[model samples]
Target: MSETINTPRQETVTAGISEAKLLGSLKHLFASSFSVLGELMQNARRARASGVTFDFDPDQKTLTVCDDGTGIADFQNLVVLAQSGWDDETMLTENPFGMGLFSVLFACEEVTFRSRGRRLRVSIDAVVEKRAIAVDVDESAPVQGTRIEMRNLAPNLLPAKHEVPSAGIVGLARYEMVEELRAYAQGFAIPVRLNGEDLPRPFAQENIPGEKTDIGFVSVYGIHRAPDRQVVMVNAHAYNVYFLQGLPINGSAVRNGTPCVIVHLDNASFIPKMPDRAHLYDQERAFKRISTSLTELVERYLVDRKAKLTPKEFASRHWTECKVFRRLDLMNDVPWIPASLFFRIGAILESSERMMDRCTALATTAQGDPEAHLLSREDVEQGKFRIWRNTPYAPSASRAAALLLKVMQREEVLALADNLPEGHWLNLCTPDCEGFTFDVHASGCAGKADYHAGDWMSKVTIQLASQAEIVINDPDQRMTPLRCIVEDDWLLLPAGFTERKAFNADLPFGDHEAVCLVIGRGIRWDHPVDALSSYTDENDEYRDDWQENSARLWNALVSGLRGDSIADLVATALNTCTEVVASECHLPHMAVVRTTLAEPGTRVRNAPRMEVVCLQDDAFWESFAASFDSAGDTALKQRLRDAFVATVRPGEIIRTAE
Candidate 1:
């Protein structure tokens, strides 16, 4: 019985490189999981499905994309799901590249498919580990249409936790999938469900019936082919050339079984890389016949609608290319084609009225929330009020004080003191009241006090004159200096005594030079003591000597200028010495006198001139004169001495009986 042995040997080959890297490169793949649903709906449309259903299982993390279309006849077709450039050619009316399924693969790990009479399932991990294209099939599945179930969704890809509606519901409240589905397929109905409930359609503003425009077309060329010419195939022949308006035509002989021209365009722009259409003729003579028919139809439409054809439409209808095909180039020749062509196409494919209703409902639902309205007047006002309270206080006070103190500080009448001196007092007296006498030597003389009497009194007169001068000179009359009287022998007025008598001791005498005062009404009395003290300390000896020699010098300077006009004489002396006049000294006339004295051509002419009326009874002058030798400039000094001696009025010489 060793007759014959039948042996069948199996051959194995390594699979090509895995597409794991390509699959991992996508961004927002799992994030926009609904876009995957849109892709599946597009696949269903290509299969000639009038209705596509999306079913979700929340607990199992699975989504089933089922379509009522001619199912795949063999399970081996499932291996081509994510592959590109497979059945996508000039012959296919829909997308030919199969990458859309890969977008689903990115979102899920396990994918199960049932088509034709077979069932197949694939796992992402298995593909990566095996580095090969693998397919397994079950021949007993009863599904008559294409059904794809994706499982093991990444946790991040899961829909937000929410209550799902029952299967009867169909609207935007379910998911955004239905809107996308309707957008791509014109008359196709898509039922999308989450956890077994169908989603509603999305709102669209442009879908109203009267809102859309009518579709138009133009035919460019004709096709002529002999009927029933069924001779054995010749080498090859270029057949009838036909053109269509707004439709792309592929015309190329097969080189290595690939098309030469592919046209792709969005609403405004054209896609690069026109596909090759050379393979369209080699498939079968039936395909060539189909191509000729489509080309003839396009030409007939162009000829019928030539009046409506724009430059772009005309070019698209008649132009023929040898190497490349461009949709935009064709469109550019047609200028009359409106941009709403795509939308018009969509409206015709779907029922415009239903789409409009769905859009309205969605818009209404989005607008129902109260927070959507812009802020009101009350809200704005309240927000502004809150901000106003948070501002700092020091900056505000500084701004206010800047305005109030501007003029006073500018005129030099009032100065800013760092710190008030010990025992210094400020007396803001009532205007026009006086006879207020206060003794300078009285205990607590440095303390503040207010004294009042009748109007038009002596002290009141003094105070009024001083205040008036201060007000006139000060740019900003912020504060009026206090008025007070000083002792006759006081050399310097104490700090804070703004309106004080100069007294005889304030003038320098003997071999001393007097410093001159500048004539100005507003003089700052409140020179900060610390700053003045620093200056004084730098010239300690000079200040000490001025104080010590005060009494003698005071008597000499004030003797001739006494009584009612002593204030004027004091002011004149200050001006001539270039000393700073106090703001409280109100004798304006003294300013004129000092100006005359300081003039270049004027001698001391107005000075008191004494004439010895009768040669002065004895030789008192002759003997006093004979004791001095007339030498050097002592003559001027001698003359001054003589004039001073003669001018002294002989009073009762009431000395405190020494």
Candidate 2:
């Protein structure tokens, strides 16, 4: 430490330089073999090097770098560079902080420098002595360039065997993201090679997951600019960072993991870097901005790439994203842009006949045809890999889903009824059965038979022979009575069943996932709560959206109630009710409403039956017609009435609450 002179007459004291500490600081910056290469490459680039080459020998555990650049005239300047700062005097070495070449020697056990008919050999001990470095000059003609040979590198300095890439050189512009490198390496004159092959280019984050197959001693030759960079996938695997034609820093130097080699094309332009050139200095927030910009660019690239797709590719991607991703909006946007591009490209992208085929395939998949699997397989064979189709996301995706839903259904659904009172398994809509009972006392309704008299609820009794029964205890939340009925067995299959609310209902509790069963009937209801009107007043100001949604829901319910009273209409009502309940709220509903025709003042008898209503299509009708042929007249009529059902058209598309 320098002592400050308090007295005017006292002379100032200065601290002497610690050579050991000075060299120690620079050594850590180039600890690894790749990091050492990064520092050295910069020095070569600074010398206006037109080309660089790297040679690795596994036998000797040695590395040699030769660069065709202006040669160093004075060998002693290396020692000066080893201890200088970012002053004008140090700038004479063409290095900002003058540590690059010195650190390269620090990382290696032994280093030899050959340039302009001069040779110098350096070791840690020789560098510490400052004068022991061996120098020999033949004075014979030599190449006007520089060559560095390093051996016996520090422990863990070189990449592990598994960490090394299978192909391309480890530390040069050899192999990385190939498509991107080829596009960006056009302007640079420095022809850098690693293991004799060009380096790979950068892939975006999403794409990087797919490139795990190529992970290893990664090297890259070039970088795509912003928008293009955004399109590439992000590789989470360890990677080496290179700036311009040289590596200024590596991801491992700052943090360690399966290191992600992050290369920035013009990082130096906007990113603040440390003086040692080892890392981006205090630029976490800045890096986020770069990441965001790159992400947006990637999105742009995807849109552009999509424009050039064949109809088959477009349809395949659409189906994959939609069926697998369950993103209909995304699917809608994909093909439209590609179609416009097809026309612009003179319709050469795909034939008109192919478009029809793609549409047919897409329609078949949309219609729930298993043959759609074949179409997706064909798509995979054509270069566009689909995750949602043939992969686990395909029908196989249900395996995991089934396992998960089994546990969830047991806990969330069946177990939920455990809280309900015993024998209180029927909904309000189900009439009192001879064997079953209801907790009308707990419902706050035993005192008044007239309570909720006209407004009744439908009770659902699910019977699985081997499993415990599930009953709808409370039919509607607004009603005071806690209704329940227990009844038949249906093993809820995991197929064609979802616990998702397919629509956004404007009603309360509409956002909840619909309780759908696989092998049995799913419950749905629509009963107007005479009391709910008080919650929504005519004078109260409501948004147009709320009013419109309410109007639409009421219309659908009224339309369902007004439909023909046949078995098909009954199935349609049940299906519509379930869909509405899934999207909005579950209310009292049934396939049939049995009402007695007594005098207006007289009491009417109402009996409730919870039964499964199947929207039997023509296929089912035809299949049942033959087997139902040979039977007794009364028995056959009863069987036909129970089994045969007319098909109802699917529910219309509803407007979004969003």
Q: Give the best candidate by lDDT.
A: 2
The deviation in Å at residue 17 for candidate 1 is: 5.7
Go through the candidates in order and give each one's C-alpha lDDT: 0.34, 0.38
Q: Over 4 Å off in model 1, which ranges?
A: 1-32, 81-95, 130-143, 161-658
Leading candidate by TM-score: 2
Tens-digit lDDT string for candidate 2 (1-658): 9988776676899988888776656565553334455555555656667766667654466777787777777777777754433335325433355556676666678888888988888876666666666678846424677888889765545445343445334332232222222333322335555456643323323223311111112222122323212222333223433333334333332222322334434423433254344455455654555455544443443454457765445444433323222223333333221111111101110122322222211222333433333233233234242111111111112222222222222322111111112232121212221121122111111110111111111111211121223222222232223222211111222222233311111222211121112111111111122111212345754244543443344433333333335465455555645344443322222132343333344455433223453333434444455566744355555556454222222343458998
As a whole number from 0 to 100, the lDDT of residue 312 in candidate 1 is: 42
Location of the lowest summed lDDT over 10 successive residues in candidate 2: 340-349
Per-model TM-score versus the true fold: 0.28, 0.38
- TM-score computed on alpha carbons, candidate 2: 0.38
TM-score of candidate 1 to 2 decimals: 0.28
lDDT of 1: 0.34
Local accuracy of candidate 1 as per-residue lDDT tens digits, 90-154: 22433344555656666688888877656667765554444554344557543566888888875
lDDT of model 2 at residue 314? 47
